[model samples]
Target: MNRELVLAPPLAPPRWYRLRRQLRDAVLALPRYAALLLFGAFTVFPFWWATAAALSSDGAGIWIFPAAFLPNDPGLRWFGRVFYEMPFWRYFGNSLLISTATTLLVLLLTIPCAYALSRMAFRGRNALFVLLLVTLMVPAEVAIVPNFITCAQLGLLDSYVAVVLPNVAGAFGVFLMRQAFQDTPAEVLDAARVDGAGEFGVMCRVAVPMARPMIATLAVFTFVAAWNDYLWPAVVLKERLKMPLAVGIFNDLTGPFAVSTNLVMAAIVLSVIPVVGAFALTQRFFLSGGGLVRR
Candidate 1:
């Protein structure tokens, strides 16, 4: 039949309805927000304690329960003591060089290897990848004895080379990069191949660009690992000047005559700055890169 058409403006929800919806959402989100806040506070407590201790005029009040959190008399004296009492600049330089070298070497080695694993068809490729995965299950500490002996045999002990060589090729990096490479679009890869691009060219021009976030994440991980490394460097590096910041602080500052909690805490604080700064700089890529593969 015959029908009449009528048009009407959309009506907004009542204010009470909107307020109720918002209140419901807030109530629903309360537990998640609470959990996050609790974990954040837990994570921050140690850094706060260390900073507080470093800023304290003396170490006596640092051990007390409530007093521990607040500096007795905040000042820069402990930080000053850290510089005067230790070869901090030398240690800083050594850590920086080693960490940078490690990051570069890891990227150089893992990218090609991961690309091959992800894109190239080869016999026993699955088996090889499985073996790499298996290596991830092994703790790094398990290899220290063999690494030390090999370093000694090669006469590379007490050097940055020895410190950096062991960590250059990591299964975790290869795995991470391989996963990222695997997510690259096959159509884009074929397009590259059709454009007179070989495997190396496709990887360099196409895959690498898309995987930049993952690469940045890997670089940050490698740098932080190399920077914070203590055990291996302590074992291999004998010379006072050769030590990285972590080893140098522990070895030089904890001696009987030099022992002071305030100075040690100050040194620890100084050592942590670069790591915090690096992560802060790359945090966006790091957090987003894990599951994201750019098209």
Candidate 2:
């Protein structure tokens, strides 16, 4: 007996069914996308408003509710005047120096301290960390009087060192670094020691290199804090030329911007550019898995 074999029609999903599945997935993802968009807009709107206000001629007809997104009459007069009307370049330089130096110092002090706290076995380690954590809870204003007195006695008042000295030993950087360094594997560090790498060598060659993401994160925060510092520096740095951008901008904006809204907005816009650029550059580190080596 011969058997006849026949193939049934393929059980493929219809085109409309596939389309429906895709639509469902997109609908499920829509809320997440919406949340991200809203957050982005919330974060970016202030910057956009400042930029738009700066470009608008005298910010005329733009300060009202439902503010104009685009300027009706844009001009660079305020931007040009920002430099000409005051000693802004000197202030900018002072801010650059202070912020950059503060960032470097924060890294130098924080990384080593964090490494020791995370890797070394020592007495009072937990207690010391707890003490540091307690310091973070203290309001910065409480330290202002002591810092001022110390600077005055040291004759560091009205100097760059005065401006930078107080901010160097930030607890936040150390805390962040400690968290980052703890994630590093001890076995890898032990292997490095077997290869004749001492503590310093291991730190420089291996741990430091691998922890770039957190380092960058701390650096950006330290830099921004330093750059935007007005109260402490203003209290310490009395010299007219020694003022940072924040102090200088606030000082200058008082009189001229009373007559023109554009000047005030322009100053805000300029003040933010350096910080925004720093953030944009360093954001890649946090995005790249917070300094963890994938391998």
**Total clashing pairs for each candidate:** 0, 0
Quote the lDDT for 77 in model 2.
81
Model 2 lDDT at residue 110 = 93
Per-prediction TM-score = 0.95, 0.90
lDDT, residue 92, model 2:
92
lDDT of each: 0.91, 0.86
Residue pairs clashing, model 2:
none
Maximum-lDDT candidate: 1
Question: Given candidate 2, what's the lDDT at residue 164?
Answer: 92
> What ranges in model 1 sit over 4 Å off?
1-6, 288-295
For 163-185, candidate 1 gives per-residue lDDT tens digits of 99999999999999999999899
Candidate 1's TM-score: 0.95
